[model samples]
Target: MTQSVLDKAFRDVVIANRILANEGVVDAYGHVSVRHPLDPTRYLLSRSRAPELVERGDVIEFDLEGKPIGGDTRPPYLERFIHGAIYEARPEVQAVVHAHAEAVLPFTVSTTPLRPVVHMASFIGARIPVWDIRDSFGDTNLLVVNMAQGRDLARGLGAERVVLMRGHGFAAAARSLPEAIRMSVYLPLNARVLTEAMRLGEVKALSRGEIEAHASMKPDDPAMWRAWEYWAVRAGCGDLLTARP
Candidate 1:
């Protein structure tokens, strides 16, 4: 069968994920997914492969039920449940990105929460809750592979743009793969700024009102996409911005 639109979208996500991975923002542990085109009950994401090295043919397809539908792949991400459950709960979300960016990884292992010390993180506001999977399972490395845990994480995220997985990593969502990538890149930058500010002493979070004000201050600027396009071209994936699956 010819590659479907859903497969193409998955390829785009894989490309962006690889770019971040090559930059060391995301390594072997993270995953990215896009909602299926014709089937809202399905999604497209990379299977068990190094995110930085993923190619178009490496993408996989799966339904909400977690059954693999595409690729001659072996197995999918163990935490595929996260993608399935999030899409199940939030119809407005079209893409999801989970990465262990260096700046955010430290906070995930610490007792303190990631306060919104910068404007970027302020999009979610205050302290983003760290979902402690270690507490849920006996081991910190246990993957959230079931619907029950997935739904719990979804509830913690609610309508927010990101969720911190305690002792693990974090997840970010957006309307498209590129937009989701923007959130992933921005989130770590926000966390790094907050962490450094904490070391320097007293850091104040942007108030909810201030965040709203900032939103009105700049509506969907092209700076990020432009930057991504530049780097993507250098990384040899410039065509991804317009390529279908």
Candidate 2:
């Protein structure tokens, strides 16, 4: 049972890496990570390869401090601190995705808050918090390059499941890989829809109660599997025949 769990986590991490790219949730610059099944204090992430190219072997183990433990020779992402600190902060979250989505960028810079403009995004509730790196550490490269910066960002993130970095990108956290990938994908789609609707007229966003109901509910597993399957196939996942999980 333990081996099965570990194997599934590893494979799902690979699937999520590819799914995010195939779904346009991430391109060359973004990244994803999944909590280690054998040890909660560690995680699985790829060396500095592009998302689409992250094969199973490219995945490396990192401790809670985000230090590579498996002697992985490839360069690790500097922003890995982003994933590390969030995992430390949120024990319930097993998956994390970070992306610089074009559609989400406007809301991060403007006073216009990104809301639950669609059903798939109702889990985002009434507002997605924006973490202004400038307010904490002014006038430098925007990357959360170190553990201290990562902790500060996590503090800003607080209880929210998603956070938008001012002048940078956004992070999505979930209890499962599919849900994390789903949020990463929908954030941009929701942003695009909201942007267009804003041009047409004032948009009526989902109500707090509506968002609350969805939050209280169990995830629709079949729907999630379908999404994962579609993305897995589209991304040319190595073993699509039995990849669902």
Best by TM-score: 2
Q: Can you write out model 2's per-residue Cα lDDT over 145-215, one digit (the tens) per residue? A: 98888888888888888999998999888877877888888889999999999999989999988888778
lDDT of 1 at 143: 66
TM-score, model 1 to reference: 0.85
To one decimal, what is the Cα RMSD in angstroms of model 2 from the true structure? 1.6
Report, for every candidate in turn, its global Cα lDDT versus the true structure. Answer: 0.73, 0.85
Error of 2 at 245 (Å): 5.0
lDDT of 1 by residue, 97-198 (tens): 877677887887888777666765555444477777755556645467888888778877787778898767888767766667766777888888878888
In terms of lDDT, the poorest run of 10 residues in model 2 is 236-245
Worst 10 residues of 1 by lDDT: 214-223
For model 2, name the residue pairs that clash: none
Q: Give per-residue lDDT, candidate 2, residue 105.
A: 95
What are the C-alpha RMSDs, in order, of all predicted structures?
3.3, 1.6
